[model samples]
Each structure stands twice: as C-alpha cells, then as structure tokens.
Target: MESCLPILLHSLCFVSLVLQISYASDSISAGQNITDGQTIVSAGGNFQLGFFSPGNSKNRYVGIWYKISAGTVVWIANQENPLNDSSGVLKLTPQGVLTLLNHTDGIVWFSNVSRSTQNPLAQLLDSVNFVVREANDNDLDDAIWQSFDHPCNSLLAGMKFGIDRAKGLDRYLTSWKSVDDPSPGDFTYKLDSSGYPQLILRNGSVVQFRSGPWNGLRFSGFPQLKPNPVYSFGFVFNQNEIYYYFNILNSSVRQMLVLNDNGISQRLTWVDRTHDWRLYASGPTDECDTYALCGGNGNCNMASSPKCVCLTGFVPKYPSDWESMDWLNGCVRRMELNCQGGDKFLKFTNVKLPDTRLSWFNKSMNLQECKQTCLRNCSCTAYSNLDISGRGSGCLLWFGELMDIRQFDENGQDIYVRMAASEVGKILAFSRQSHSEDLELPLFDIITIVNATNNFSDNNKLGEGGFGAVYKGVLENGQEIAVKRLSENSRQGPVEFKNEVVYIAKLQHRNLVKILGCCIEQDEKMLIYEFLPNRSLDCLIFNQEEGVSLDWPKRFTIINGVASGLLYLHRDSRLRIIHRDLKAENILLDMEMNAKISDFGLARSFGGNESEGSTKRVVGTFGYMSPEYAINGLYSVKSDVFSFGVLVLEIVSGKRNRGFTHPDNRLSLLGHAWTLSRDQKFMELVDPSIASTLNPLEVLRSIHVALLCVQNDPHDRPEMLSVVMMLNGESTLPHPKQPGFFSEDSVSEASSSSGGKHQKIRPTR
Candidate 1:
C-alpha cells in the first residue's frame, strides 16, 4: 500500500510540471512564436503586439497597442489584410524586420528594410512608437525604419505629419473605408508645400478643405486655435522635412488626431479625471469651411449676411445661379485687361489671400517692384511680397484666378487684387499724396528660427494675439525668449512696428518690457523678447472662474506690482514714457503674478519737458486707449494716466474696462465703477470671483486712487509716483474730481468702428 501511494504522488507531480511547461511555450520571441491568444510585451511593458479583432469585428488583425492602456492601438501590421481565424503568428526575423503569417504560413504582412548588421532588434519606444534597428545602435538617424514614420490615420504625440522630401515619402492621414472596415477611405490629409506650407484635405485629386498657410501665428483657417492645457502644436520646414506635429503638454496625458470612418478628423485627448477621452477641437465648423465655398475670385465670411462675395473686379459667372445660392460656378472678371493700358491693383484688407500653388516667387523684390513685374507679364493677375519682412522683400506673382479667399476679423493675410488701369492711377495718386508709409521689420531665416523655438511647435506658443501670435523659445545653452510674429494684414502694424522696437529699445526699466533681438529674413519679421511663463495678468485676474485662486494677499501684491511698473515707465525710465495702450492684456504676469508692463507697441516716449504726443492715426485699441486719444486724437501723459485709472478700477472690480456694464446708465466699466465708488457701493464693484479673498480697506483705497487718476481735468490727474506711493499706503491720496467722460445723466450714444454699433458704449474707431 505504501509503494502504491508513492507512485500516485510522483504521477501527480509529473503532470503539474508538464502543464507549466506547456503554458510557457505560448510566450513570444524573435525566432520563437506567438499564436491567436498570445502577445509579445515590450521591455518596459509599454507596448504589446498581438492578434486582435477591432470593435466587435471578427476579422482578426495583427496590431500593436499600448500595454498600459490596452485600448490605445498605435500600429497595425495588417491594415489591408486580415486572417479568417485566430491562427495567426507574429515574428521578428534575425535581420530585424517584423513579419506576420497566417495559419498556413502565408505571409500576411512583413516590414521589409535593409539591415546593416547580422543581428538586429525591434524596439518599442516609451512614446509608444515602434522601431527596428541594428542591435547596438539606438540612434533614430541610423535606424532602418520605424512604424511612426509610416503611420495610418492616427497621429499620436511625437509623430511627424509632413513630407520627407529627401526620401520622397509624404506622410499623411487617410480615413478608414467604413466603421467596420480598416481599408483606406476617400479623404486624405497632407502637408502641401507649393507656396507656403498649409494643411490640405483631399478627396481623390480634388482639395476639400485647407487649414490655410502658417501666417506667423495660427493657421489662417483655424481661428479657434487658442491657449489650452493639454497639448501644443508646431510646424517644421527646413531642408530635411516640412512637417506639422503636436506634443502632449503633460507626460501622463495621451492624445491622438484620428480620421474616423465618417470622414471627419477629430483630436481626442484622454482625461484622467473622468477616465475617458475628451474632444479637444473639430474642424470645418460651417458650410463656408467646405474648401473654397465661394470658388475662385471669391471671399467667404460667416458673419456676413451673405457669406460669399466676389472679388472687387469679378462678377458672378452665372448671375441667376449665384443669386439662388449655387456658387460652384464661381466668378469671372467684369472687364477685359490690357497690360499696356497701365493695369491697376486693388487693395483688399483683412482677408486670407488666394492659394499660391501655381505662383512665381522672387525673394529680392519689394511690393513696388512686384507690382511692376506683374505688369510686365500680361498673364500676371496679382503680385505681392513673397516674404513680408524688412520693408517687404521678395515678390510672388500669381497668373491664374485666385482661389479660396476668406475674411478674418482678427488676423488675416493681405492680397492685392488686379483692376483696370484707370483705377490704379486714381488710387495710387490718392495714396502718394496722403504719405502713409509701410513699416519694415527684419526677417529671420527659416533655420535660425528653427533653432530659436525648437521649430515653433505647440510647446512654444505663449498665447494667441489679436494681430498675430506669440511664442516662447530658448537659444543654445540657455537664453529664454518670447517671439511675436505679426500678421501681414494687421491694421495696427506700422505704429506697433515703430512703438515696439524704436521706442522700447531706446527705453530701459525693470518694470517695463524688454526687447532681446529682432529677426528679418525674406518675409518673416519677428521680435525676440525675454520669455515670461506666467502669461498676461488678464488670464488670471479677470477670469471670474480663475480669479478666485488669487487671494487678498496676491491681489494686493499684484496691485502694488502694477503700480511700480507704471511708475517706472511714467517717471523713472530713461524716457518719461506714456503707455498709451495700458490695459489688462498689456500687463504680463511672472510666476508669482508679479506685474511687468509689456506690448509697448502703442507706447509714447516723451523727451524732456514734452509730456505727450498726439496723432491723427488714433492707433491704440478701443478699451485701453484714453478717451481723449480714442475720440479726439489728443494724447498726453495725462491721457495715459486716465487709461491707468481705468485699469486700476478693473483690477479692483475684476471686470474689463472696455466692456463693463450696468442696468441703470448702460455706461461702460469706467462709468459704472465711478458711480459705485461715489455712492459708497464700491464693494459691489469687486469681482464676485475674488469677493471672499479681498480686504475691504485695500479695495476701497485702490478704488479711490483710481478715481483720482481718471479726473476730467488733466491738471488734476496724479503722476504715477503719487499713484504708486498711494498704493504702498506711504502717502495720503487727494480727493477725487469728476471723472473724464463719466456722466451718468446724459448717456453717450454707443458707436463702434467698422460699422459696428452698440448702445451707450463709445468705442475707439
């Protein structure tokens, strides 16, 4: 009986050992094997490659997905091919390339590439991109090929979406055939570098939509691209490649730009808080978004009652059809042209110019020379500076009809339209007599800029601007910087061009903005400045939702800091400066929300005994400019003092000085604030966002000081020194006088520039 028991125990132990070895055999390796239910995990456990079916489809495909997030499929071995059953095998050859085979050993998909070494390895990077290379060489430049370089419809962070010009490999996104089918679909997105670089979506050989050319700021097509917390965008255009890519701002965040089966491109970002994905942005928001809805020689503006309008010289090709809203026929020139008759060019402002695909370019020609060159060739319909930097160097001539024009109220490109000869003569005579001059800025070479902003990717954007865009960058070793690239058609250019460089460069102060350097190359003029990461104060103090975070102490500190900065600009700086455009947006915040005056684009530097300078141009913005400056073109340091007063009141009230409101008088922020202060209802003016965090005494004192600054009599306004001292609680403030343009009894008729009208709200035209 004892002998029989020993035999049974030994049999049980042998069975257990055999079962363990069988389970281990299902593991995967280079020459070993993997079957239907098996997967090969990368070294860091970041990626998993195996056979799996997608979205309930029984068609088994060999693919790679993140190990941490099992649902994130990054690459697929069989996008066009699939196995009938689960009997699939994935293997890495000794030569380095990976291959997948079906149950019959038929090659399903194989990565074919030249291998330098006898032994090689396949690696999946921490960024979730898979690569193949020689055993000892991990450098990307020396690699054979990578799955990242050959992406499907999904564009993940760290992936490039552009042309590999040298390799003749143009990477783009192709939509899926259908929800259940993984085959390529009709729509394809690619980087078109014909003139300037632009993102274009195509249906076969026809373009469906365009993301517009990179206009030194955001894409001309996407006005909604603004400051966001999750990711940053960038474009690379050098000798090696011309690509557009984006990266996750947070390392833990996962995001993807995918073209789904529905022919829509969507950007999806993972939200850890919800344990789900969130939509970041969507394109083609309206019918006008359909590529060139107005067709050739036409402009589209959603805000307009009729979105489509023909160019100045063009009339509808089919008048009856066009009136009925069918504009596909586009437009035709109203008059025949004879170049010998002295052809004229009409100026179109605030518009995304026509496409430059079939255009001729010369980097040396200015706008004037460009006009002559276009006239010399009868085929030339329009001509412009190929590059819009440094007095406008370069000439690009268009011979064909202009296509895909759109209006952008904030930042649009300038394009001159061809007109009859007599029209040019009349316009040219009028312009030459008025003596308006163009501003010139130095342009930065494409390479020098690449080294400046790490190629101007999303990570570099400081924030969006009304005229253009700003980016933060670092030079070699360590020189932090901010770069502002102005749009070509910004109405505020010439003044801003002079104010930022000529004025700010000559003045110096700790509290004022600093100019580091300038770049001028071809048409790319950029101003380099010291980078400030805390962004502008408006992002913090006025955001009712975000203002709650600034407690009483922080608010008090900010108030004092701004006063100090203004004092330096107004009194202590080398030149007694009047920040004519003083507003919340002009005040930048440091890491501590410490105020530093910036955007001196409208600032005036006064010499000895000279208190102010006025211009008929009326350059500053509506909300921030003093009433005298906005209404009568009369400006003085006292004018700036009035603007400062408005800013101070806004800080106390946590409201915008330009767009403030009240039910009784319908006055702007300044009027409402004055009324509340005079009635001892000043506490009511404090922003509700920071109500719980403010001290009543400090708030009241700041409001009083603000009222004194806005006094109607320029003689009664206090100097910045007095204002700063009052904020410090070091000196007694004077009693307030009647505020400028602040009468509650007689409401000013509201008017706006560019035909916009509102009630009781006077705006700078």
Candidate 2:
C-alpha cells in the first residue's frame, strides 16, 4: 500500500506540473527570461505582455495589449529602441528591475528603479499596468517601476495622464511616428499642471489645442465629456499630483484614448457586434479647435462664416491679413486701457475661457472680489471664476492678451475683458441710442410716447400681458410704433425692463421685432418698438374666426421665421439670448403676416459657455414653459426650444395650448401632438383650416422637429441651430423620448391660470 501511494502521488504531481505549464501565468520571478514568441497574460486574462511588431512593420518591440484584441498595443517598453530582428527578450532581474535584452546578450532597454531588492518579479495587471516590484509587495505606490509612468500613444483605463509635482515626472501620451512605426511622433498630449490644470496637445513645442481648465465636472472646453455608461472620468489636482483618469463602468467594455499618428486624439471603444473599434469621440473637431486659430484677443466660432473674429473692443492688428482670412497676427485693442479708475471690464458670455498659460488664480475669491482684484492689477487683462461649481467660487485673472478664445452655443464659462472706460461708455451709449448711423437702437422720451399714444388712451391699446399693456402709437414723424408700458402693479420690475432694453436694443433680425427706442421717466417704463398692424400671433392662430386667414403656407412661413429668429438668438447673434417667454401671444405679426418675436422682458443672456441657469423667479406662459423651467426654475436655450415646440404644434392645429383638451385622451396640446406623432398618425393633429394646403412631408418633418424640441430631457431637445437645420431638411433628426409635461394631470396643474397671461412665479429659494 505504501509503494502504491508513492506512485499515485508522483503521477498527481506530474499532472499538476503539466496543467501549470499549459495555462502559463503573466508574471515572471527573479532571474527569469522570456524570449520572443513567449507571452504572459494577466491573472484575469484582461491584458497580455509580449514582443511584437506594430501595424505592417517588421521592427520588433516589447509591449502590452488587450488579451481580447489583436495588435491593440497600450504600452511599449522600448518604442525608441526597436529591434531589427526577432531576438528580443524580456527579463526580470534579481535587482527588482525589468530589462529588454537582445540575442547578443546586450541590454537594449531597462527600467530605472530608485531602489534595489533581492526578491523581484514582473507582473502584467488587469489594469494593463506592467510593473516590477518585490515579490511580496502588492502596493502599487511601492513598486520599483511601472509602465504607466511611460505611456506610448494610448491612454488606458486606470492610467494617470498628468504630472507628479514632487518627482517632476510628466506622464503623457505621445503619438506614433506613423501607423507602421512605433517611434514617438511630433505631437504629444499632456496635462498642463501650471495655474489651473488643463489638457494641452502640442506639435513638438507649438501648442495645437488646449482643453480649458477642469471645472469640477470636466474640462470647461469639453462639455461633451460627461459621465456615461461606458466609463466614469475624473481629474485630481493636489499638492502631490495632477492627473486625469477614467475608469470603465463595465469590465466587458474595453476602451482607450489614443493620440493617433496624424495628431488627432480619439476615444475608441471595442464593439463585439462589429468585431471592430468604434470611435466614441475625437477632438480638434472643427477649424476653431485649432490652437490659437483665432489668435490672441480674437474669438473663434465654428457656426460663423468667418471662423475668426476679433474680441469686442479690439480690432485686427493687420486688417488686410484679417480680410484675407489670415488671423495669425490676432488683434490689438482699438483703445488703450487706462488702468486707473478709467478701465472697465466687458463681460463676454457662452465662451471658452481664454488660455490660462500666463494667468493667476485665488481659490477663495468671489466674483466681486475678482473684479476688484483685476481692477487693482495694472497687468490684468481679463478675469473669470476659477471654478464654476455651486454658486461659483474662486477667481482667475489673466495678464496681457487673452488667447485661444472660442464661442460655444452651450456649456461655456464667462470672462470679463478689461476695456478702456471710454469703450465701455460707447457700448452703453450705443445700447441706449434711439437712432444713429453708428448704432441701431433709439432712445425715446416719455413725452413723445405719451403724445403718440394719446396719453395712454384705451383706443390705442393693442394687448395686455403680465408685464403691462402694449399701445399703438404714431410718432410726430408719422412713424407707427408699439409702446410696451410697464405697469406699476406688474411683477416685472426695473431689472426686467432694463434687461429687455439691453437685449432687444442689440438684436436686429427680420423675424425679430425691431426696438425703435425706450422711455424711462418718473417711475414710467416704456419700450418703443416698430408697430405691426396684424397684432399678436395668438389672435390669428387661436381665434377660430381669424385662424382661417393663416393658410398652410402662412403658418409654415411663421414657423420658419420664428425658427430663424430663435437661431439668431441662440447662435448667430452677437450675444447668446434665451427668449424665456416664447409663446404665441408674444409673437407679433406684421402687415405682410411675417412673425416677429417680441417682448424680451423675461429674456436672459448667456455669457461664456453658459448654457443653462437656475433662478428663483420663473417667468413665462405656463403652456409654453419647459418642464425644467416650470417645475425647477431651471432655464436654458432649450427652455425656449420647448416653448417654440409648443408654439409650432399650436400654430399647425390652430389651438390654444393652455386650454387644449384631447377628444379621446385627456391630454394637452403637446401630449396630443406627441401621441399622434408617436402612433404615426401626424396628419390627424393638423388643423382643419390648413389641412388641405399642407405638404404632408413638410408637416411631418416640422412635427418631428417639434417633438425633438419638446423632449422630456433638456439634453434631448435639439439646439435652435439644429432645429433650423431639421426644419430646412439640412440634417437628420433623432427619435424623441416622451414630451415634458405630457400627462393630462401635470398639464392641468401647470396651466390652471386665467387670461392666458405669462405666469410669473417666485420659487422659494
């Protein structure tokens, strides 16, 4: 029995050895060497370490790649020292170092470890990190050396891309020379740890692109990089290190960010269905994304025809070059800033805060303090909030010219640029001007308005709103004007009145109501606008007797015109404005039945990438208000888009959204439109008066765009610019989720008010 037991134990031991050899590990102990073709895989089989060539190249190199993917190398051990033959050998030395050796027994490359140990091992981790550490040491921070410190072209999950302040070790991704070559390329993507931490891409030493500073959530310039199903990303800036990293939400979802050979940085993800990598996102997406594309003191807007334009209060240094579209020389101030008390800052909104290469910051300063600080500094050219989180804290002041400024339709930061007080005064005066060749606005006297309207007589009354009454007035020069007089008992105060004046005075578009001038005297606030004979849009669209006059063509024109006006306010205009009170009653019709957007009293201007805002005061018609704005007091350009969507449905059906009740379902107009559209019965939602004159395809498209605009999620709602494109059939529209406030009960509760007047509620802060 004892002899049989020895034989059995010997056989069992041999079998165990064979199994171990078959499923070989991804780790090597001290003094062990792995020759070419011998590979090591991670314990979890997520990553593999081996010697290989990169894309159609014969030169061999030691690298690590995903075990599930072929040739998708994430790290290269000896990228600069590539072997000409397949004689490369990776070895873990007894001194706790990893070295790449040639067939000639010469060291080709080696890991530089600060300390040495007798017991050493090299292991490939599931995080795709290759490290050489003491055999018993499991802590990463105590490792002798790691591949994460020397990345190639790719940034893998759990890898830090930034700087180790104490060690002065810069960890960054460098592009490959070419698809076939693994040598370092001209372009490098790294974190600029100076001032506020930001990502910067450089072609050699020249900056190519800069990801604006981290703003708690993301890099201000990269608003699209939000937390998603694929991964969770974050930035850490501290005394020890400053780095950006991402973690995969699901282990199965393999992802990587690679700075490609052509200098384009792309986030790619593996898709099992396609058996290929899908591009999740890419940057330097437009012409404006080019670093310093608009140069210093200039702003770049991709939506504009001329991509580059000088900043306000500045002019091209070389006018001829600017005219020829060469903005390399940037711009110079039109008027020199006199530092004393004569310099004022011009606030710019919805913009990518300027490059912070030469900047200063204070983590605890408020906006008011920031302004005072900038005012005190003679070299300060611009100032903004250092961190835009919560009520906004910290201060950032820029010296000299602001560079790499880009305008965004949404998600931006605000910057106040120092300007000559005279320039500031000129702008203020221009905003108040009644009529001048240099300005478009006109300032009218209260006496002139009183005389034009016959001293506020009822005969000249056009309509009454939440703000006040609109009166038809005839100027002494025989020009007809509509005067919007603020009621003493109205909820809208001087702030709203001045807000309207400031916004309407600067905006000029065919579809936007023209502001002739304004009158502010002895507690009387009046806005003078060009008179429209046809009155408001609701009078024509909601009244059954007058609705028939608006044929399909006229309604379509009105819709198109309103969209154009909205597009202007949201993108093309000098200032990004949100028409909070976008409704049928606020839309005025001209003599030719052209729709003109009026009443900017509830409007808000977004500055420096300011996409949305929250306020205690929610002002807008209930039926037209987006769910976010109505329920949460959160307003954005999308809020106006939602209102526009409701208006479109109302325009097409000739029904008042406020009192709308579906015949079969107890739904509001928006709910009814969404139901019909969802069921593919769009024609049923059309108004009987214009049904015969409607183009089926056009109406369907318009309905689709409207549905997109009224989507339950604000992000699901298309931007006004996108709305315009969809209306003109210039772009494809996505299927909408449920419409906001689609339920009958919710709609009823929201629209319980009388008179169809704009609702002004002050939410408890």
Candidate 3:
C-alpha cells in the first residue's frame, strides 16, 4: 500500500508539470521573475522577450525581438547598462513597475511609471511592446508604461515617432554607437514641432537632412513616399499630440526603420523569398538631400548639373564661387525691397517649402489672409499654407532668408516670396519680350476669377483632369469663359502653366481653343479660355446617348477640324509645336460640333532647324504615346501624328484606346483596327450608333490613315500636313505596317519592366 501511494503521488506531479507547460503565457505576475535563458513569447507568438547579447557582444541585455526572425532585436531595456555575465532577471513588481535585476538582486534598470497600481502584471505584446499594467486591464492605452515610448535605434511598426505636447514627451530615434554597442550614437532623428512640423536628422547639433513639412499626403521632400500595397502611413498634428506613424497592411510583412551607426536612416523590409532584409528606401538619397545644400535663397535640383541655382528675383551673391560649383554663399536679391504697399509676391511652384525653423504660423488663416498678413509685415520674406489637408488651411510665414529649398520632380508645395513691384513688372516684361512674336496674354486678378466662377462652386465645375478641375465662369460683360483651376495636389508646376499660356494664347485658328488670360494670386493658378458650349469630345463620343447626336457627317467634320488644328500646330503656328498630349479629353467642341485642340500644357516648341528632341522624363498619355517616345523618350513632330491617329480611331469607334479589348484576341485598339482594316472589314470597326449613317468610303479612308499613323516605325507615319491632305482626298494613302504597342503581351512586359502600370505613368503636362 505504501509503494502504491508513492507511485500515485509521482503520477500526480507529472500531470501538473504537463498542464503548466501547455498553459504557459507571455506574462509575468507580481513577485514573479524570468531569469536568463528563459523567454516569454507573445500570445500570437510574434515577439519574444528575454535576455540577449547583440551582434558579437557577450554582454547580456533584456530585450524584445521578432519571434520568427530570432536575432532581430526591436527594443532594448538595458541598452546603456549591459551585464557582463548571464545573471539577468526580468521581473514585475507589486507597484506595476517592470525592473531588470542583476545576480546579487541589484537593480540594473527599471520602468518609471507616473502612478503605481495594484495587481500589476508585465506582458510582451505582439507589437513588440513590453508593457506594465494592472492585471485586469486589457486596454493598451491604460498601460502604466510601454517600451515603445522609449525606443532604441530601430523604430518598429505601430511605434509613434513624434511628440506629446500635453506631456511634453518627445519620442525620437537615436543611432547605435556601433554594430556591437546599443548606446546612443551621434545622429538623432526628431520631429521639429515649432512652426510647421517637419522631420529633421541631426548629427549632434549640425543638421544633416530635412524631410520637408508634411503636406496632405506626405513630406514634400519625399515625393517617393506614396501609398503602396505593403503599408499605409500618415502624420497627425493636434493640440494634444504631433506624430508620424506607419502600419503594415499585410500581417505577414515585416518592416522597420533603423537609424544605422553610419548616420543613414534606412527603411528595411523582411523579404521571405530572399531570406534577408531588403532596403525599401533610405534618407539623404542624393546630394540635394544634404541639409541646406544650396544655402540661402538658392534652389537645388538633382537633375541639373552642379545641382544648385539661384531662385528667381535673386542673383549669385558671389558669382565666381557659384561658377566654380561652390555655392555656399548662395544668392542675394536682385533688387532691394522698399516695403511699400505696391510690393508684389512672386509664387514659386513644385518646390520644397524652405526651412520653417525661423518661421511663424497661424492655423486658422486662409490663403488670402495669409498673403495679407505677410504683406503687412516688413520682415516677412515668404508665406505658404501651414497645413495642406483637404482644401488647404492655415498659414506659415518665413521672416528671414529662406534656406534648404530644393526642387522636386513632382509632389511639391508652393511658396509666395515677397518681391518689389518694379522687379515683378520687369520680370513680366522680360518674359513677354522674349516671346513677343506671339500675342501678349493678360494676367487676371483672383477677385475677378472668384466672382466670375461663383467662388469655384461645385455646380460650376465643367470637368477634372490630371492637372486640375475646370469651371464655367461669366465675366460682368456677359463673356462666358472656361476657367482651368489648378488643384493644390496637382504635380503640374508654374513651368507647365506658363507654357500653356504662352503657346495657346499665341495660336490662332478656328480649330484651336482660344486662351483669354491667366490668374496667379496667392496660392491659386488658373487659366481662362473661350467656352465651348458642347464641352469636350470625350463627353459626347464616348457616351452611347451622346454618340447618337453625332452622325457620320458631324463625326467626319470633327475629325477634319482636329487634323487641321494639328497641322497648324506642327507647321503653320508661329512656333513649330508638338502637341504631345493629343487626346479626346483635350479636344473641345463648339455649338456646331467644330473640334478645337486644347490643353497644350505638354506641348513642346522646336526651333526652325531642330527636327527632334529627347528627354529623360517622358510625358504623355500612355495609349496615345508613340512607341519610340514611350520606350526611348525620343519625341518629334511624328509623336503628335501618332496621338492624332489614336484620337481619330477613338472618335470613329466611340471607345477609349486604352483598356479596349476584343473577344477575338488580346489586342489594343490600334492592333484591332489594323486587323479589321487588313481583312477589309472597315464597316465593322465603325461605332454601332453611327453604323446606319456611315459613309463607307470616308470611314474606310479614315481607318487607313489612322493605321498608317500608328505604324511601328515613326518614319512610316505620315506628317500632319500629309494627313490633312489625305483626309481631304488630296493625296494617295500608303499601305500601313504593324502598329506599335499592339500586343497585350508587349504592353504587360513593358509595364512590368518599368515598375508601374501604363496608367500610373503621370503626364508632365
């Protein structure tokens, strides 16, 4: 009986041990201790908390790391005080405090909570946050203390990298002293919340990089920080807190931002396929990323040689130094300011708003009030919107010389710089004289535009484009006009705005839209043009109900008018212009359905002897783009010819060139047209609405000309002059070859190799 009792006791003890192992939790209660070599894994098993030695160091430190990627430590508890031997013990006190104790019960590190609580517990969360709170509290916000509030060199997902205004707690990232050492290094990345909140990286007290102020979408300096499939990010600025955070969209994906010992901040993502961490992006990406690289009153453009240039209304302070590529002295104002009421502000677009370190801000001021406030202050050098969310609100004014300004290819903000009225007038006069061969364009005031368009009411909106929205406006004299208002979020800059004004204003033809004037006031940019009662060709041709109104005759007339406009632009206009973005949306129609070419923002003007030009940045619609231009960035008059060809086909078929598919095969509109023409089934290609009213000969002739224009080789396409003559039955049509971008496979391959879809490629216009 005694032997049987001993066996029964042993069995009960073994059962108790199994139950404890099965129910092991990632939490420690009061008076409990987790010694070295023991780990507490989160409930989801995503993170583990234990003592570890970083890199090659044998010294032990309490930390938390991803459970899957065992060696990747995210948070360190005893970073400054490393233990020589493996005698570390992590414990939770009865006062809701978490502390790390040494071998002799000596306190090595502890969490300083504002208040003590009963029934305390320490938990290692899946977010890699080590938290201490009341045992019954499940809410993370109710935690007494969290490791995320005191991050190490790595900023993990769900961590707030910002400031708590109410608590005066600033959470920032400091680099590690070395790969083997977790102590603070020389570089620190923090959010400067003084004027307009922006992220700045500093090496000690010296500024190394400035991540331009957060515009509605992202930091102006980080144009590449766009929405992606992997993660979502945003910035928050309010009375209580100001911070930036990012969260991964997919739970399987792991991403973190690490400020390396070398002072480079890198965004790295774990690549499962590669079995390693891949660099997603890095700060200080180029020479222009250097803080104040262009110095005061200077602009840096990475695409340009020497990278630095003086801002408009300013000249090199030291010409010799600037010429030698040593632009440390920057530039000085060309004309001294008199601080009179007659002073005007010159607006610079597509640029990183200058440093806000020495700036003032108002959160409730509109753009007009901001300009007025700046104009009233003699010391104000520049002014811009403090917050660009929604319709744009608030104001930021810079008093001293603007610094650290750089040019971005896209996604930039606008700044209004104070300039003498005389200087502004002189600059306008110089611009006018330079293009005096064309008609002089008038600049309208903001008030006039506002009253004309009823404050840009939604009901007055005509349409929207990649650049901005268009509104219907009427002058006091009863002159109806179409107002093209540039949106604050638009990537189009003053360069394209001025280009359209200069080119379209000078172009005179019954088939070309007339530009009446332009308006540049405060932060607004708009162009006024003669209103076409029938709207754009897309609103009609693409609509089944609208297409019924345009019979064969009207459609033929519309095609002929567009060809004439293109011919004039290619040869007859004062400037030999190439309408790179010729499309259905850019074609306006009058009351009589007469087509007029519009939106010349992407047009390029060539010298008399220059036949072609190449650009690193290709700009145009994908479906209308010429194969040579879209693939190699080589553009010429023939590029317009190809776009005209696509427009002609769309008008005939009532379908967009892009996204057009056939049941027979996966061919683009151009390819489908070519196949139909080759089979002599031209009548089948015409729109069903106009099928009954079709003039067979004219339809066949138009399709043939379009096919010739879309030929793979640019040399095979006819010039606009020849195209006009052919459409008028004045010239013989040649047999067309295979068209460019015809196969779906080729399109897919091109899109994949380019790292984006065809529709995602933005038109510079």
Indicate the TM-score of model 2.
0.66
Instruction: Score each candidate by Cα lDDT.
Output: 0.67, 0.78, 0.78
- Please, what are the lDDT tens digits per residue for candidate 1 over residues 1-765? 000000001123322332333322212325755566666566555566666666556787766665545555656778899888978877777766677888789999888685544656666666767677776776977777688877777788888898988877788887766545566778788788887678888888888778876544456677666447877876776787988878889877777787665556777766778865567766656777778788888778664435776765567888787778777778888777876765667665546656767777776667788878888888888766544423456677787788888876434555667777533322111112235434222223456567878787878777655556677765532345688876675444665665676555445444555554466556665777656666776777778777777777777787787777777777765557787777777777655666677777667777667887767666665555555666666788788778788888877777776555576777767677777777889888887877777788888888888888888778898888888778767466666877765632222321233123211110010
Candidates in order: C-alpha RMSD to true structure:
17.3, 13.6, 19.5
Ranking by TM-score: 2, 3, 1
Cα lDDT of model 2 by residue, 679-765, tens digit: 999998888988778888889888888988888899889888888888988466688888988866777565443223347531100
lDDT of 3 by residue, 1-765 (tens): 000000001123322332344326888999998887777888888777777776667787887776656666677888899898978888888898888899898999999889998889888888888888888988988888888899877787798989987766889888777767777878888999877889888899999888888877888888788899998999888889999999999999988888877778778788889876777888778899888887899888764455787765677888888767888888888778888688777766567889887888888999889999999999999998877767688898999789999977445777888877644421132133245422224456687789989999998888775678889987643456788888887646677776787777556677888776677777888888877788888888999998899999999999999998888888876577887888887888877888888878777887658868887677667788888888778899998889889988998999988778776799988889999888988877789999889888888899999999989899989898889889878466788999987876666555554445434122211
Work out candidate 3's RMSD over C-alphas: 19.5
Which 10 residues in a row give candidate 2 its minimum summed lDDT? 1-10
For every model shown, the clashing-pair count is 13, 15, 0
Which candidate leads the pack in lDDT?
3
**Top TM-score model:** 2
Cα lDDT of model 1 overall?
0.67
Model 3 has an lDDT value of: 0.78
Poorest 10 consecutive residues of model 3 by lDDT?
A: 1-10
Model 2 sits at a Cα RMSD from the real structure of: 13.6
lDDT of 3 at 83: 90
